[model samples]
Each structure stands twice: as structure tokens, then as C-alpha cells.
Target chain A: MELTIKQKKKIRRAAIFTALLLFVLVWLLPVFGALLTSFRTMDDLMNNGFWRMPEKITFKNFGTAWSEGRLNRYLLNSFIITIPSLIGTLALSSMVGFALAKYKFKGNMALYLMFVAGMLIPFQILLIPVFKLSNELGIYNSYWGLIMIHLVFQMGFCSFFLRNYMITIPDELSEAARIDGASEFRIFYQIYLPLSKPALAALGTLEFTWIFNDYIWALVLLRDDKLKPVTAGLATLKGNFITSWSVLVAGAILATLPTIFVFIFLQKYFIKGLTMGSGK
Target chain B: MKRKFVPWMFLLLPLILYTIWVIAPTIYTFYLSFTEWDGLTSPQFIGLENYKYLFDDPTFYKSLINNLKWLIIFLAFPVVVGLFLAMLLSQDIKWARGFKASIYSPMILAPVVIGLIWSWIYQPQGGLLNNTLTYIGLKSLTRGWLSNPETALYAVIGAAVWRHTGYVMLLFLAGLTSISPTVIEASKIDGASAWQRFRFIILPLLKPTTVIVIVITMIQSLRAFDFVSMMTRGGPFNSTNVLAFYMYSEAFRNYNMGYGAAIAVILFLIMFVFIALYLRQIRKGELE
Candidate 1:
């Protein structure tokens, strides 16, 4: 039987919808399992398993994790590291990016390429040297040490991002400001910096999430328990709550919340950043 | 006078921090790779002795092979799924936004969290996968996934793909959205099949994006660390060891800084070639 146009469209739409539904379910199952497991009590978890819905949904695991687990401290370290690193990176990268993007000068390509190549190296290679260097700088096991590492490493990608971003802003605005009495720094401070807010905020969100979720860096650098970021702190959770699956899952969920909020709320900016950062 | 130095002044902070923390350390790693040190005391230069040791180490071959396996699996699975999903999502559909967000949510989680979640699911006894297998009467298939050398790496790769595929889809979707609708419409009017139209018109246009997906996935696979380290720690006779983990274990755990640095330098060279090729591509594009 020859299919009518409406029928064919309907069939195709059904297929598309089914495929998308299946993909989303498959992708989200592990996430849902973790969330479901977090809500369950250990008793239920031991008896019924992680796949089943909780017999009694409870938030006590979150309470225990926050207080007894000292997740609060880890979350605090996350902010201490993420905030200054964010501000410094944004400030430094945009300044450097503005220079590279707008200026025509000698060594421009080389300088820009240096930043680009800096990003391409496997950062783990720098682990030994960076560890030793931080120790020498007398900042080992300190919050500032991790912050400095985050800032320097992120500069490459951030500069590259801001430079590319700043390029797209019509050169006219900066040129007009240059023609005026405004200094180049003033132009950047007043004009280009404000204009690049969207890129800045997006990169800031990504940078925050990244440094927050950093495992190896925190594991290597921070020796003090109080200074451990949430990611490193979560690894420690496994040792304390070896049998308490619920508490560990709850902690993981807590560790994930800020990034999740940033992701869902500032999704467009996040996607834009990801797309712009496609090749890396 | 301030204006004369303002740009350089701006360059100063980033340059100082970056050079001291990043550039110098990177270059020093090369020299350190030749010398024996425990991250302390005086260094004794041994000159390719570390690399020679790495070459003869059987575990090095195992880890290298696993990395290649990971690279191959990632290149195949995530790229294909991402492209298909990107195409699927780009089509006008109800709740596409919701579906897109749902699919991409995993990307927001820490790799450790992803690893933790999957590890539970893959548990051999009373775990999600084994339970489901028993329910479906595939009870014979159930085994300790992380402890099983043969299945361990592939199982970890599956988790990596789960996180990566969504990221890949998002990139492809961004690229797909920019294509002119007229090109698609014109092909449709010419009685071309969907596959034919995609092959002829869409694929070529997506060259830039395809380059991105290939390059990024390759780099990600090569740099695979957190998932493997968190989930398996290169266990079950080091079957799942990748260069990054092996390098990390050597440096921090064993204090074989020189050997680890050597491993890292080799990994760097492999990645640098790709980075150079990518840079060349960008320069060519600029000329166009």
C-alpha cells in the first residue's frame, strides 16, 4: 500500500521519538541509579540492591555526609580554589587574550601559539616537576599551591578561548576607544572586558567545575585533610564508608550539585564553551 | 611611559606564572627524564636509561596496548553515536531540548562519580549488571568485571564512552545547526534518499566538525586517567594500565620520577605530533 504523506511523516516522527527516548534512558540509567541509591538506607541497599527503589527514602545520609563526613570542608576548599582561580584566570587570560586578539605586533603568532601548545601537553607530564616546584615555592599542601596550579594550567585554554572570542567583537569599538583619550588598558577594562562577559562567565563555570572536580591534583598536592577539595575528599569517603554505600553516593551527589546547577542553568553558555573548545 | 609598557605589563603576570609553573616545568621534564631522582636530593643523569627500562618492561607494552585499544574503541563508538545522536536531535522534534539536556547531564559529573556509578552497576554479585543478567537468564555471563582482565578494559571503555558520547553529540549538534537549510532542501527535492543526501551533502560540509571529533576523542583516549585510576587502578595483573596511570603510579607511588617523566615525555611526543598537525590545519584555514 502506498503511504500518504501524513502517514509517512508520522511514522518517521515516531521513529525519531523512539530513538531519542531510548538514547536518553540508556544514558541516564547510571545517573538515576546513583540518585536512587543515595536516597536508600544501607539496610535496604544490602537487602534489596542498588537497582531497586528504596523501601524508605531518607535524607539522613546527606546529613551524615555533610557533617560527619566533613564534606562541608571539602566544599569550602572547592570555593577557595575555584573563586580566586576563576578571577585570576579571567583577569589574566582576558588581558592577554585582548592583547593577542586586538594587537598587531611582533611575536604575536609565536606568543599565541605558545599558549595553544601549552594546552596540548598532557598535564600529567608536569606532575613530577609541578609537585617539586610547588614544594620549593613553600606552598606545598596549601590551598594556594593548588590554586596556582589551576591558574597557570588553565591560562592556556582560557587565553586561547578569550583571544578567539575577543577577535569576533568588531575591532571598531577598540579602535574607536584607542582614537579617543582612553588608554589601551582602559579600553580593555571598560569595553572589551565587559563585552566578553558571556564568554568569561561560561569559561568561569567550566573552570570552576573542572577545578572542583579535580582528583589527581588535589590527591597529589593537598596533604591536609581540611584543605582537600570535594573530589579528593570523595575518594577518602570510600575508605570511611566502606560498607555505607548510601553515604558515599550521597556525598558524590553533593559533590556533583554545583556543576549540575551550572550546567542546567547556564547550559547555553556551557554548550557554547564546549563547541568553541571542540578541538581540544 | 605607562602606555609604552602597558601591553607588556599585561603580558607579564600571565607570562611569569605560566613560564615558571608550566613552560619551565615542561622543558625541565625532558632533562629530568634522563636523570635519576626521587623528587629530592641531587640528580644523576643517566641518559636514556629510563626509556630503555620502559622499553623492556612488559607492563609498558601491556599499558601501551591498552591505550591503543582505548583509542580505537573511542574513535569508533563515541564518534559514531555522537554523530547519529546529533543528527537525530537536530531534527525538529518535541522535547528535543529536554532530551538534549538529559543526555548531556552526565558530562557535568566528575569522572570519579561516573566511575563510581558504573563500578556499582558492574559489580559481580547482587550488582545491577549481574542481577539483570540473572533475571534475563544470562546467569552464565555474570562475573567480576573489574577483576576480570579480559573484560576490564573494555568495560572501562564502555563507561568512558557513556560520558564522552554525549560530549561528542553536543559538538556535532553545534556543527550541524550551522548548515544552511537550503542545501538540505535542495537535496530533498532532487529525490535523494536521506542516507544519500547525508553522505553527499552533509558529510563533506561537516569536515571541520569531523576533524574536531576525531582529534578530541584521540587526545581524550590517550589521556585517559581518572576513570581507569578510580575504577580499576590498573589492576588484575595490570591489564587495564594506560600510560597515564602507569606514569602516575611510577612517579607518585614508586617515586620513580625519572621513569615516570620519561613515560610522560613519550606520551607528550605522541600528543605533540597531533597538536602540530592541528595547528597546521588552523593556519591553512586562516589562509583560506
Candidate 2:
């Protein structure tokens, strides 16, 4: 008995579905463990172990993690750090991106290459130098210092991405605006900026997540616990809450919520930004 | 005149910031590599001394070798698996968005969170991994995966690969989406087998994406500090030390700023090769 083409296609689809289902489950096992463990009490983990289901679920960890673990403050710091950095990055990068995309000048490619390559430059080299520079500049251990670094350092990647994106925007629009006697800055503000919203929104989400989750910069640059962003703060919680698995894991989850939220909300733009920059 | 000047007006602030924070520091790192500085005092000139010391340091060699190991494994595993997953998801499969969201969720989590999550999984006693091993009656295979020197680096690498696969998949999915469907349909009408079509058509067309993926992966492997720092801190006797972590520990922990700068210089030089290739690719269009 030969199977019909539709039947064969159906069978093949089912097979692919099952295979993907199995693979995704395996891939997500660690996350599932963290999520499950976050809901259980320490006693439950101690008695049942990390592999088993919780005997009694608890939600107190979230409350305690927020108030006691100092995650609330850290989360606030993350927002404080990320929002300004995001705004600054967008403003600076968009301008540079526009300049690089719209202008014809000596050292244009050189400037563009500098930004792109700077994005990929190893941070290890900048670690000590930036730390020293920050201290020398009287901005050490301050939110502004970290915010400044994030904005400046991220400008390279953001400008690079936005430049690639802006290049695809037809030149005729800008040229038409120029012939209308509009000033360059006015044309940028009115026309190019509006057109660049998708790219800006994409870069905004990416930069927000990156600056919010940054651990290395926050660790070396800031000294005060109150100044630490969620990533660095949660790491400190890991050490301080050595015996409390629930609170630590809860804090970890809480720390990721903002970025996760941004990712979910701006997912379309996020992926678009990523694919756009990859030379698609 | 006004046209040329207008672009510079836009470029001024970013250029100043980039030069100060990125370019100057990069140049200073190279200069610092040739001197001895404790980071508190002035750096004293000692040309090539740090490099000579790095050449003779066993830990440096270990870290270099470990970085190579990381690069090789990353290229082999995540890139391959990501491409496979991308291809699978690209076939008009059901619930592709849900699956993609699930797979790509880990990439959004901070390295600290990922580190802690994997620690729970790799914990020797009552940890998920060991318990699963024991549940299936392979208790002998279960041991302290992270505490053991032999498995520490590999174990950390395993966790990193988990976080990285989704990113690679996202990249490949983008690449796959841009591929024109007419070409594939034509090949299929000619009775090309799935394997033949992929090999002869899809693979050849995906060269640009492949270049980007390989370069990005290589650079990422070189920057493999976060997971190592979060999980092991180059521990079990520095068995997991990559160059980035080693440099951090040396400069920050031990106050060997000059030595750390030298290590950074070396890492930068290694990354420069891939960066150059990537730039060459981008330059082909020349912002047209």
C-alpha cells in the first residue's frame, strides 16, 4: 500500500515537530531547573534535591529577594543606568551613522571602520585604562561614570549597525529635503530621524539589555554596592546568600525581567536590527 | 563647504567619545604593555619585559591553549547546531515562532544568571545532572563536574555553548530568510534530494552569512570571560583560565596592570585578524 503525497507530508511534519520538541526541551532544561528551583523553599531543595519536584511551592522568595536581597535597589540602578545610556547611544550613533551614510568626505571609510572595529575590540585592554581614567576624572564609583562608559563604548556598535541600516535608505529623500532649503540638521531631525525609528528602536532594546546586564564594567568601575547594576548586584547576592538558593535564584530571575520584558515587547525590531546589521 | 561641514557637526560628539574611551585606551594599552605599572603609580618603561615574561609563563600557555580549545569547540558545536536548527525552523514548520522564542530566551539572560543556572545543574550532590545520571543507573558517571580540574573548563564551555547556540541560530535564520525561494523551488522541481539541494545551492549561497558567523564566533570565543568568571573564576587551580579572565585576575586582583595590559595586547592582536576580514567584507559595498 503506497501512501498519498499529503499523508507523507503530514507524517514528515509530525516527525519534524517531535524532533524539534525534544531538542528544545533538552536545550531549555537548565532554564527550567532555575525556574522550578526559584519557586521552591530552601528546605524543599535540601530534602528533595534540585532534580525533584517541589513538595510545597512558595512565592515568598520574590518578596524577600526584592526587599532583603537589595535587588529592588539594584533593579532601580539598572534602569537609572540603562535609560540614559540608551538615549545617549541612540542620539550619538544615529548622528554618526547619518553622517557616515550621507556624507562623502576624506576618511569616511576610516571613521566607519573605526566604529565597527571598535565594537569588536577586546575590552580587557580598556579595563584598567578606563578604570584609571574614570578615577582620574573624578567620576569613579559614580553612576555617571558607568553611564558615560556604556554610552561611549556602545556608540561604536550602535553607529555601525545604524550606518548599515541608513545606507539602505534611499538618497533621494534626503536630496529632496536638501533642495527644499531645509537645513542639514533640520532635515535630519525631521526626515531621517523619523525614518530611522525602526533601527533606533532596535538598537535601543539591544543597548538597554546590554548595559543593564553588563557585569564586567560595573564590577571594576563602581565600588559602592548601592551603585551596582542588577548583574553585578546579583553576583554579590550569590556570594552573600550562599546558603539560600531560593532567594539567589529568585533575584537572578528578577534581574532578568526588564530585559526579558523589553525583548518580548520589541522582539520584532530586535531581530530586525540584528539581521539588518549582519549585511542581509 | 557647508555640506562637508554639516556631516562633521553630526560626527563630532561620537568621534570625541570614541577616541577618548576606545581609541586612546587601546593605544595606551599598547604603550602600557611596554612598561611596569602597579596602576597606582606612574608606569616605568621596561620594553618587551612583560612580553618576555608572558612567553615564559606556564599559566599564559595554559590560558592560550584553553582559549584555542574554546574557539574550536564553539566553531564546531554552536555554529553547526545553530545552522541545523535554523534550517529545521525555516521549513514552514508549525509553531516555529514559539520554538524560536524558547530557544533564543537564554541569550537575553545575563551571564551571571546563566552562570548560576548552570551551577545548579552541575552541582555534584543532588544537582540535576548527577541526579539524572543516577536515575538512569549511570551513577558512576556522576561526579563533581566543576570541581574536577579535568572537567572544569569543559563544563563551563558546555554552559556557554548552551547560551551561544540560540544567538548563532538567530544569525543563520536571518541568513536563511534572505535566500530567494524561487531557487529552492526550481531545484526541488528538478528532483534534487534534500541533501543535494542544501549542499549545492543553499550552502553555496550562504557564504556571506557563514563568514560573519565564523568571525563573530571566533571573536566571542576569544572574549569568553563572563561564564568562566561567574562559574569557576578560573578555578580548580586555574584550569579554566582563558586570556581575558587571566588578564582580569592579573590586573585587578594581583595589581599587575602592565602584565595585564600585555595580555590584553596579545588578545587584541589575535582578534585583529578576524576584524580585518570582517571589515574587508563590509568595505566591498563601500557604504553604497
Candidate 3:
């Protein structure tokens, strides 16, 4: 039977709509279920299904997670590691990127390629060596070790990102500054730094979330319970609360908030930063 | 003298720091791969023993195969699903932004958080996934999703696909936006069906984005560690172990630094090959 054009179009439209709705439900189910679980009591979770409504909503789980789980300490540790890593990556990568982008030097392209190659190398490849080196240098289990690893790993991508952005900044700006008697350092500080704020902010936000959420590195390098960040901390929480579903949900939700906040606040720049390498 | 000093001065700090921290360690890692040292013992020349061990170890092979599985599955699911969603959402749909955000929110959560959340969902007895299965009257389908060796690795991959499809969708969305509206309009005016428009116009135009997505996904999937560690700890007799997690276990947990270094080198070579191939493809695309 030959179908009319209008009928075919209508069928296609309905099929597409159904597919979209089904995909949306699949995406949202776990998140919504987790949210609902976070608000229920352990008794409620044990007695009722995760999807079921509780007799009353409660904030006790969040309170327990915050205090007993020592999330405040982990949050502080995350910031301590994240901030320096951010500053170090941005500062080193920008300077290196500026030199590569602006000045003609021997092995400039070679160095740039080195960073690009480094980006492709998985962190696992670097893990054992880094851990050994950190231990040998007496920085293992210390915040410094974690920060250094993050800086080194981040340098490759940051330089790659900043170089691409810096290339578009035009050589004329730097040359004009040089003609006006601005030293290179002075120009980097006074001109380039100011102009690169948006890019820096974008990269910084993304990197902060990454470093804060880093688990494998922290697990390998930082052995002391006191030094572990929220990600690794939550893993410990999982171990302790293995049977307590409500507490686990609470811990997971708490761990997710900082990254969510960063995303919500820097939503626009975060998207741009994430897609930076893809476009080029 | 001032001019000469200025260049060197500007280069001093970064070069010195990066060399000490980055370049030196990389070279050292290679050298360490040939030595027998466990972070406490004196370094002794071991030749190729570590590499030989890596080749023979069942765990390493399991990891390598699992890594391959992850790469293939991760590459297919996100791109195919993401492209489909992006195309669908590209239509003049209500609440498209909300839909996009709901999909993308998981990507923003830390992988550890994702791992934890999914582990709960994959719980054998009373977890969300099993409960839903039982709720819908398919009680027999409910099983130990992450505990059983057969489904452990795939279960983690499912979690990853859930987290990443939106990210890949965003990339496709951006690629879709850059496609000229005039081309799409002209195709429509030719009485091209939706399938024809997608096949003849959209797909041809989306090649660059697809390349980017594939390369990124391949790289990420190969390096996947957190999910494996958190969800399975490569457990149920080393079922879900991937190269990254295996490398971690060897070095940190087992104190086999040299062996771990060997695994790392292998992983590096695998990634290098993929990246080199991708760069060549990108160069070819540019020429075209």
C-alpha cells in the first residue's frame, strides 16, 4: 500500500518525538532516583523502593554526610590542591604558549609537538614512575605531590589550549607593546594576562573540577586518610556505608555539589573550554 | 648584553621547572622500566624481564583486552546515540535546552561520583536497575550487574555511556550549528525526505566533528581507570581490569614498579599509535 506524503511525514514526526522522549527518560532516571534517595531515611530506603515517596523528606542524611564523612576537610583539601594546580598550570602554560606563539626559537614547533604528544599519553603510563619519584623525593602522601602531578599533566593540555587561543590574539598587539618600550615580561603581565582572562577563567574552571574530582592519582599517591580529596574520600565512605543505601546516596550527592556549582556558575565558559580542542 | 639576557631570563623559570618535573621524569620512567627497584631497593639492571612478564601475565592480557573492548564500545555508543539525539533536538522542539542540560549534567559530575551512583544502581538485589526490571515484571532479567564477571566490564561501560553521550551530543550540536542553513533548506526544497537530507547533506558535513569525537572518545576509553576501580576494583577475579587500573595495582598496590612501568610503556605505545593515526587523518582531511 502506497502511503500519502502527509501520512509519511506525520509518522516520521511521531517516531522522532517518541525516540527523543525515551532517550530523555533514560538519561534522567538515575539522576532523579539518586536525588530522591538522598532525601530519604535509611529505614525508608530499606522498606520502600528508591522510586517510592517517603513519609517525610529529611535533611539528616546530608547533615550526617557533612559532619561524619569529614567532607569539609576533603573540600578544603580539594581547594588546596586545585587552586595551586590551577595557578601553576595557567602561569606555566601561558608563558610557554606565549613564547611558542610569538617568538621564533629553535625547536619551537618541536616543543609544541612534545606537549601535544604528551597529551595523548595516558596518565596510567605516568603513574608508577610518578609515584616512585614522589616517594623518592619525599613528597608522597603530601599535598605537594598531588599538586605537582596535576600541574605536569595539565601543562600539556593548557599549553595546547592557550597556544591555539594565543595564535588568534594577533602578533600586532605584542609587537605594538614592544615598540612602546614594554619588556616581554612587562608585556606578558600587563597586556597578555589581562586580555587572556576569559580564556584563563574558562580553562581554570574546567581544570579545577578535573583536579578536584581526580581519584586514581589521589588514591595512588596520597595514602594518608587526612589528605584524600572528596573523590577518594567518597570511595572510603562507600566502603564504610556499603549496606546503608541512604548514607551512600547522601555522600554521593554531597560530593557532586561543588562540580555542579562550578558548572552552573561557569556554564557558558565551561562549554567553550570543553570544546576548545575539538573545533581546531 | 641586555637583549641577550632578556630572552634567557624569560625562558628560565618554566624551562627549569618543566624539565625537572616533566621531561626528566618521563625519561626516568623509561629507564626505570629496565631496572629492578621497588621504591626501596637499590636499582639493578634487569634487562627485558619486566616486559617479558607483562607479555605473559594473564592479568595484563585481561586488562589489554578489556581496554580494547572499552574503546570499541565507547567509540560506538556515544557517537551514534549522541548524533541521533543532537539531530532530533535540532528540530524545533519545546524545552530543548532543558533536555540538553538534563543529558549533559552527568558529564559535569566527577567520574568518582558517577561511579558511586551507578554502583548503587547496579546493586544486585534491590538496586534501581534491578528493581525497575522486577517492577516491569521481568524478574528473571535482574541479576548481579557489576558483580558477575560476565557483565562487570559491560556494566561499567554502560555507566560511562550514560555519562558521556551528552558530552558527545554537545560537540555534534556545535557541528550541526556550523552547517549552512541554506544547504539544508535547498535539500528540503528538492523534496528530499528527512532520511535523505541526513544521509546526503548532514552526514557528509559532519565528518570533521565525527573525527574529533571518535579520537577523543578512543583516548578517554583507553585511559578509563576511575570507574573500574570504584565499581569493581577489577574484581570477581580480575574481570573488569583495564590497562590503567592494572598499571595502578601493579605499581602502588603490588609494589612491582618495574612491571608497572612496562605496562605503562605498552599503554603509551597503544595511545601513540592511535593519536598518530588520528593526526594523519586530520592532515588528510585538511588537504581534501
Best by DockQ: 2
Model with the higher lDDT, candidate 1 or 2: 2
Tens digit of lDDT per residue, candidate 3, span B9-67? 65577667667667776777787789777768876889999988878889989988999
Evaluate all candidate structures by whole-model CA lDDT and list the values in order: 0.85, 0.89, 0.83
Per-residue C-alpha lDDT of model 3 across residues A71-116, encoded as one tens digit per residue: 7788788889988988998898888777766676666666777777
Ranked by lDDT from best down, the candidates are: 2, 1, 3
Writing each residue's lDDT as its tens digit, candidate 2 over B40-123 gives 889999999999999999999999999999999999999999999999999889999999988888888888788887877788
User: 1 or 3: which has the higher TM-score?
Assistant: 1
For the record, the alpha-carbon RMSD of candidate 2 to the native fold, in angstroms, is: 1.4
Worst 10 residues of 2 chain A by lDDT: A271-280
CA RMSD for every model? 1.7, 1.4, 2.6
Q: List, in order, the clash count of every candidate structure.
A: 0, 0, 0
Give TM-scores of the second chain, every candidate: 0.96, 0.98, 0.92
| Candidate 3: docking tier | medium
Fnat, model by model in order, equals: 0.64, 0.79, 0.58
TM-score of each: 0.97, 0.98, 0.94
Expressed between 0 and 1, the share of native interface contacts present in candidate 3 is 0.58
